[model samples]
Target: MADKKNRYNIRDHAATYWENSPKWRRVSMSIAFIAFFYALPFLNNPLVNTPGSDFQSVLFYPVGMYVLMAIGLNIVVGKSGLLDLGYVAFFAIGAYTMAILGTHTALNFWEILPIGIALSMVAGVLLGTPTLRLRGDYLAIVTLGFGEIVRIVAVNIEAIGGPRGIAGIPTPPDLFKAKFTILDPKPYYWVLLTFTLLVIWMVRRMAARRPGRAWDAIRQDDDVAQLMGVNTLKYKVWAFVLGAAVAGAGGVLYASQILSIVPDQFNLNVSILILACVVFGGIGNLWGVILGAALLAFTPERIRFLSQPRILVFGIALVVMMNLRPDGILPKKKREHFDPNWKSVEESGEGEIK
Candidate 1:
């Protein structure tokens, strides 16, 4: 077994890797550059609207949501080594909760935000409880089933508008109750941007704590983690809850931006799309997941002219990626020096390795 001090030393190095990743700097700069220029359309710049493009506003919606979802899933699949196929249910629940409670009913947007969180947390617990006892393929199957169930329920439940879903969701309060509505989407972009950054920060913090270590232990080997006194059930649930919270945040943001909710929007396709982002990007790397999400979200639109063949191309690309770089384009954690018995000065002085 590795010494405890040695493990801490390794964690310190891994922490430093996150603090010093050039990948983050590149991604941050790219986002800033895009944001700075994306507003040209709002400026009514005719040049920004190439021949027949109506995508000045709607384009950013997918980008924002994908980034948020990828970051959220990164917490579970990347950091904790849990394969969650039904994560999209949380997003659906959040969006629908906000839609129903924040609109059709008398509750306001601000009032429903807490409800969204609470409902999502409860959903997370409910989903996690039944699956944590299972591992790997079984857990994946359970989550997939859960996602299907949610989508089916949303479509069949008449109260939530069934397959037609709900529309005309209320927008957030305007600036000091001004005349302008807050559903224009540019504002939502900023909101999601801020939210994404917060999720990343929280993920990094949680992934560096004792709970994070427990997750790692379980991921590496649940049996070993159990032998080491780590409560696999507790940590597994933590992963699900945290991941669900991020998804819920995305959901609320989606409702605020689109001002609508639909069952079709949160189907198995959504789950597969998010999982593809995480898998293609590199399981544990948040930035990679973000990159994957952006690529998958943006590329399809870029080549829509090809129609059905374009999807084939995307599938081919994924196949190539699987064949060529199965580990993913950006791996969350890289191999580092693994010294099982590296001693600190204090430890060496006390001869504690015995």
Candidate 2:
């Protein structure tokens, strides 16, 4: 019982697992990380693209998609505290953008991808501008309606595949000019992983600067942030656009990977699933979101050996985890700054320091 209790302790491991690692080890870890992601798709390893190795595909590919989706949703829901529940609309926008262009036009995958991203960004701006004044539940409701509207439009419109949807979408054109197929999951995983890395880098850089602080301020208190002269609307819109672009990029990769897309694919369920990943993971923490998405996405496969009640078990585990650590699996590390007079209290770690 004690061993099990220790194993499930969240508070003790609030910091990163590798925080104590030496500099040399950290460098080595970084290099290995890059190689693993880059080589996984085409590497000849048994778990890679080998003829019989579909396990990695089944496990990691969906995890990759969810990771991208969760990371995107994090910007809006985590950073700006937007409470958006219609984010999958942007995903559909990107997928359909590629699907329509690939099937109806003579464009290649590479050419169609940019169009999809741009359209998704446009959709973000359009959605954000109208809902700028709304807050909390109002914002959530509007986003939910917007997401449904996007799906309904796709269902009713025939030119963009309609209810039956588009099919025979082509795979991406790689630099080697090699013909690719969706049946082969390696290329799709590699390409999507590359975009995911790029998005992470961009988000991290933005987070460390003024834009990051702006979003933080808005999230903490929008009226106060505005009182301090910050452009809350602009920053909120920026978050929306950024999240949409990430989702758009992921959607393009997904459409190319699946080679087929229907309106129903980007419904409310996907949005909620992505949101659950963000909430389950530490909101406002990028790595937490990634890990959360991966854990949730891959848990079903990992628990297959648990037999018939795997889903039930998974649900119970999640409920218990949240009950124990409502902040998330790993909440963002927050420091409490104290006024000069409270120095003694801060040092002693006693009294009301905050």
Candidate 3:
């Protein structure tokens, strides 16, 4: 029993187990997990449903949208160790793009989708080009300003409906008889789920390659990484661009589902909430980020009976969780432990051998 307890301590040994498992077994398990999430909306479990909300609708909005945005932010904040307080700028850009084009142009949802993502990438490049050189607090402040600027610009632009925002954004064309309607949020949830899975798959693939190594090196020490020949500026811009792309995709989905949006919808608070999700979950761990976003988004709605005080409760819970797990609920394992007798070295006072 003692041995088992040690093996399954506070750290995530389960992830190690999964990593070491056979590829076929992992593939099968992944398929099963995907199936479960796809069927989640249909479950209609009263136990999991919120009292004052439509569970399906909630799943698409705060829950699904938050998870998607969190994953994107994780790339910039977690993978690259960038402090982006204005991450919501990309979200707003994408959302406004969809709203304006969908309302006035001849483009359909699929057509506008690429345009929104492209425009978001451009926005990211523009922001990173001038500000990537700044580090620490300076970088964070610039990003925060960028987020506010996007919202303020939208509010002043009458062509985009200004503060009132655009309405009548066209929904995605029907798929396999699954009609997209405000009343039935299941289709939207499925669409977002599909995109979420795709992003996860892509991120995992990237995390195993050169970009991942560059990010790790930069995160450990930017100056050292630069001395070692890593193009710090290029990679930082890449992180910003990719992260923006993800947010842009999510925004398009959100606008289509809601059929309307306002400038107030995209604010600094949204960025803070997203960053909170990344921090709450193990920052560098993908699954942990997803879990954090889901829980944080769901908890407030789950306890809606507490009314406005739910925000206070949420804040207290975050404080408590941080105190208990400073590294996050499932902090990423930095290195593998291959040597069974490694602990003996520490005990002998030799410490870790470089």
List RMSD in Å for every model shown: 8.3, 6.3, 5.3
Summarize candidate 1's per-residue lDDT along 1-354 as a digit string, tens digits. Answer: 223323333334655865777997768966886676445336554433323334445445566688788888877787777788898999998999888877667887667877887788899999898887886767788889999999999999998899999988887776544332543556666666778877888887887898889887776667778999999899989888988988887898688767777898898888888888888877777767888887786666666667779788988888888787665776544442244442343255321111
The lDDT of each candidate is 0.75, 0.79, 0.87
Segments of candidate 2 deviating more than 4 angstroms: 1-25, 39-53, 177-179, 304-314, 336-354
Clashes of each: 1, 0, 0
Model 2 vs. true fold: TM: 0.84
Task: Write candidate 3's Cα lDDT for 231-336 as tens digits.
Answer: 9989989998999999999998899899999999999999999999998987888988999999999999989979989999999999999998755776776353
The parts of candidate 1 lying over 4 Å away from their true place are 1-59, 175-183, 336-354
Candidate 2 residue-wise lDDT at 109:
80
**Compared with the true structure, what per-residue lDDT tens digits does model 2 show for residues 20-93?**
77889888987899788677545454423324235557544568899988999998989888888999999999
Residues forming the 10-long window of minimal summed lDDT in candidate 1 = 345-354
Could you tell me how far off, in angstroms, the CA of residue 319 lies in candidate 2 after the best superposition?
Answer: 2.2
Whole-model alpha-carbon lDDT for candidate 3:
0.87
**Order of quality (lDDT):** 3, 2, 1
TM-score of each: 0.80, 0.84, 0.91
